[model samples]
Target chain A: MTTPGLTQVLLAGILVVIAIAVARYWRLPVIKDMAFGSVRGFVQLVAVGYAVRFIFDIESPWLIMLALGIMMTVGAHAASGRVKSVKGSFGTCLAAILTGSLITLATMLVFKIISFDARYIIPLAGMIIGNSMNASALVIDRLASDLRANRLAIETALALGKSWREASQKFHRDAARTGMVAMLNFLKTVGIVALPGAMTGMILAGADPVEAVLLQVIVAYMLLSATTITSVVAVELTIRRFFTRHHQLRIDR
Target chain B: MAVTGSILELCNLTRRVGDGTPARAIVDNFSYSFGFGRLYSIIGPSGAGKSSLLRLLNRLDECTDGSVKFKGSDTREFAPCELRQRLGYLFQTPHLFDRTVRDNIVDAQPHLSESKISRLIQQVQLPSGIVDAPVDNLSVGERQRVALARLLATQPEVALLDEPTAALDPANTEAIERLISSVVTDHGVTVVMVSHSRQQVVRLGGEAILMVDGQLIEHGDAVGLVKNPGTPQGRRYMNGEPQ
Candidate 1:
């Protein structure tokens, strides 16, 4: 397959035009979001493509680490932005994403499955950071909402001598599950339902099919590890905010 | 668990809520002392901080000013879990865990013996067979009884009830009122209940503290306070008129 150029990319713009037209004709509320999102996505991805190219060219260890730090920060900010009820969640998101991505990346490097090179570490870390960011956000959002919604039940438990952790134990499980559910479903339905983006991209880039499949398998496990860690960490941090040192539920907070 | 002096004391208790704008005190400078093995009903209209004061007692909501003393010591000195265990709270609409009634009671006091659990169930006037029944299947009145039994299982020195019978019918209300009275008279648990109904207050008949805008309006015998309030605010509140 030949590499797609600017002309090919311009042709893809037609799809966005069609989507926006349909949204306008239907009088949908998403028209503005659709238009802005499409434009924003193009600009962001283009910027990322250039940045990745530059990072790959440099191949400096310090540069690679710096790039990962920037990516995680941006990812954390975006993740925290999605959650409204939680206060001081940016720190939680940052800590979770950093822990998840670093641990997963370190495992891959230590096992020599992926070398500590920019070409490998940067792309894989990007995937881990992206997924972990989402998982952290989901965990915080779900846990905060669940805690608020079940205030009476939790307070009842607290009033009966249960600690904060004991009172919100069920919610911890639920929020962690919410964070991981998407990845879990993806793992269950990966090959049979649809080819995942990474695998598909590798295949489209003319990599051998079996090699791509193996890489995809590794990617799957990497994501599972990252998201599990991220979800658990997010829950640990988020649940603390809803309770006081005295184990009382701070419902208003 | 012998009867002594005041089991719970509120000293200038206050809770203020709000952001940038002026913080309004929800439970403002309220002071009272609840005696042992007695029933005390906190009577007030809506937003009078009846429930707020109950919350402050158990440290469910932090007091912005003043303190709550449990057994002659500031409540903060004890671990919150221990404090809550000793001072059991029942909400207006009881929230029973999604489990069998027995499990709900056990959840409160894990070490409660089978016979003790049975007695608690009986004390709350719930049918013996209802122990193994799922709380989801029970009526609201039955759930309230289960919650009461759960509170009793803790063997708390003080039972802080927040409108325990607001959701119950007249029959259920009377049944709960009786159970509450028995908790004090028989079990020796000091009951501080928040009741919207003036009639319920008279029926409980221990002491009634009338709160208006988070301040104590007047407090005296439940019968006297409900039947013949001393202050204008108390009189207006008893008559169901705006204060």
Candidate 2:
């Protein structure tokens, strides 16, 4: 269920108007891209809402499971291409995104923190899936840029017959840290400085305020955990692709 | 004929592209070595693994599985950067970064000053005006010089150039030849060039390694191979006979 409160609508409208104004004033090249993105977001969200309603009516667990698997695969591929650092390494990425998000979703639903329904499952998955994609992309891109810039140091380590992990050890930690920072910031401001959409929706729908607070706490924790796991998995797999068993980068011609 | 050692041995080093699904070896089973202070050129037909072989020296392509030793050390053991530092590479087509021509030359060592830059730029015979100009604005030959200057800047012990004179005008080609001759004479850089021109290799005068179907078929003194290539590989390729 999409939230339809006055505050939410007003905030969104203001964001759009501000975005246009900023683009115009700064002569930004991405004004069209921004507008196009917003329009696509609206259409996709609307379509997903309708699609979830139909799935909820079917009440088939297998179908729900299939839906989740498809979401993870598509999300992983999109995220892979989105950043040069990760460079489309999908096998590990798909596993990470799916396992992390689904496990978190399952635990929350069984605990009654979030009700077990398609409406909740689909939306929670969307939120977790979107953020996981972003964090993984950041992690992969950071690793790539780091690798590209310091290839000399990496090769020096390799020439000494060091393994891929040993060669890129310095970069691995930094790239993971950068990706984790966003999740950390989200955790810090979960309640005090901001009211998240899921929590606000529950509160507006007249659930007991305490229950809503507890539910939102679970959501925040799940998002943080899922994003962290996905980011780490993305970085490690991406770095391994940078070399081969013979300790060489298979450069594309 | 002066055939060099199996310093770097390749039993069946092949590199096949197009997903190399089964990992086919296009630059197949190439066995050769870096003889001390000796120059060599890997000449072959189009689609041959000439460039791929050059890249293999630096492990730019991990598909090269066989051994490429250097000074009794297994090439596989040396780090890619270390291998590359000892061997300079000039791409078939010249390309510079999105900065000034001088910056492209200084890419290998960014801390170079105006005086050092001018000397190298002059050595490559680039006009002084080309330094400040945008790299993208230069002709292909000018870009080649910049790439050559950058290679020299790295102070590599071996220079591997893929079609170094392919895109040049006659004048530019002659200047590049002179630059290569001087670099070899003064810098003592072991040069391995991939050239189709018999005339150019004759001008440069060194050893020759001929490849076909990813295999090294003939390698000997350049003068000897060009005059009377004993192997079927040398005679057929030089005669331009239909395969």
Candidate 3:
């Protein structure tokens, strides 16, 4: 199968026009978002595509690491925006995402399942970083809200001589689970509900169906590990903000 | 009524809330000494910082200035969890874990034996069968009793009762009052209860501290303080006069 050219991409513009027309007809408030989102997505993806192509051509490990670092920093910044109510959220997100993505990628490289080549690492890093970013954000947001909402329960536990970790144990589990729920659901209903992006992209690029399935399996496992690590790290960091060294619930933030 | 040596002492305890210029003091320069094997009731109108003072005693909220000494040592010296264990606090609204009554009690003392759990149930005057019952199945009164049992399971030297019966019916209230009295007499647990009801303090019959707007207005024998307050503000409060 041949890659789609600029002419074929121009044809996709008709779909965006149709969506904007429908929004206009319905007088929806999201008309501006829809129109702006189309342009922004186009620009962002095109820029990323060029950047990835340049990184892949370089074939230097340092350049690959630099690209991954940039991706993680941007992902952390985006994740932190979702949890603006918590202090030090950016640092928390950065640490969690970096730890999760790097650990999973390192494991894959060590096992020789994936090579150090940028062609494999760059795209794989993108997927792991993206999933870790979302997981980190969800964990932080849910934990903050749950801790604030259940101050009475938490304080009661602390008053009963429980450590801060023990006092917020329930909330920590809940927040971590909240972050992983999406990935778990995706695992449960991946092919039956919808073919995931990596598998579909592979199939569209004319890879053998069996090979695509195998690669998708690896992607799923990588995500599960990344998200689990990210969620746990996020909870560990975020829970500290709500509590003091004295086991007191300090939600001044 | 003469009491022995103090168990908990608060010296110039103050808690200021807010970050703006001139932060407001919720508990302003409060000082008190609570004796062991005795019950003390803190009576005050709404927003008198009675609850705030209790929180400070437990170190649930930090004091901006001053210190709380448990058994003559600064609270900071002991680990916070260890201090809280020794000084148990019960909230106005009971917060039981979403599990069986037995689990709630066992949460405080995880290694508690079955016989001990049953003993705690009986100590709180709760029905023995309620132990296996889910906390969600229990009424507000039952929940409060379970909470008290949980508080006692920690074997705290002092119990900070923050309106333990606030949500209970008159019958439940009477039962809880009896339990409070028994805990003091039987276990010799020091209790510092915060209550808005003047009559409850009189009925509890111990030392009483009256607070208004973050200041201790008056304190004496409960019945005496309620019947004939020394200060004009205390007298007006007893008379139900608006401030």
Superposed model 1: Cα runs more than 4 Å off = A14-40, B1-4, B20-22
User: Pick by TM-score: which candidate is best?
Assistant: 3
Q: Kindly list the per-residue Cα lDDT of model 3 for residues B1-243, writing each as its tens digit.
A: 223378988899898898867898889888888888899999988889999999988989989999988888888888999989899999999999999998999999899999999999998888798899989988899999999999999999999999998998999999999999998988999999999888899888989999998988889999999999999989989999975
Question: Which 10 successive residues of model 3 chain B have the least lDDT summed?
Answer: B1-10
Interface RMSD of 2: 7.2
Give me the candidate number with maximum lDDT. Answer: 3
Clashing pairs in 3: none
Q: What's the chain B TM-score of candidate 2?
A: 0.88
Name the weakest run of 10 consecutive residues (lDDT summed) in model 2 chain B.
B1-10
Candidate 3 — number of clashing residue pairs?
Answer: 0
lDDT of 1 by residue, B186-242 (tens): 878899999888888888899999999999999999999899999999889878899
Error of 2 at B158 (Å): 0.5
Model 2 whole-model lDDT (C-alpha atoms): 0.75
lDDT of each: 0.90, 0.75, 0.92
What digit string (tens of lDDT, one per residue) describes model 2 on residues A1-253?
4657647765787798899899989999988998898888878877887778889999677877788888888988887777634445566567668766877787787788777667677778888988887777788888888888776556534433345676678799998888789778878887778888888988889888888888788778888888877777877777777777666653343
Q: Who wins the DockQ comparison? A: 3
Better of 1 and 3 by lDDT: 3
Error of 1 at A6 (Å): 2.5
Q: How far is candidate 1 from the true structure (C-alpha RMSD, Å)?
A: 2.1
Ranking by TM-score: 3, 1, 2
Candidates arranged by DockQ, highest first: 3, 1, 2
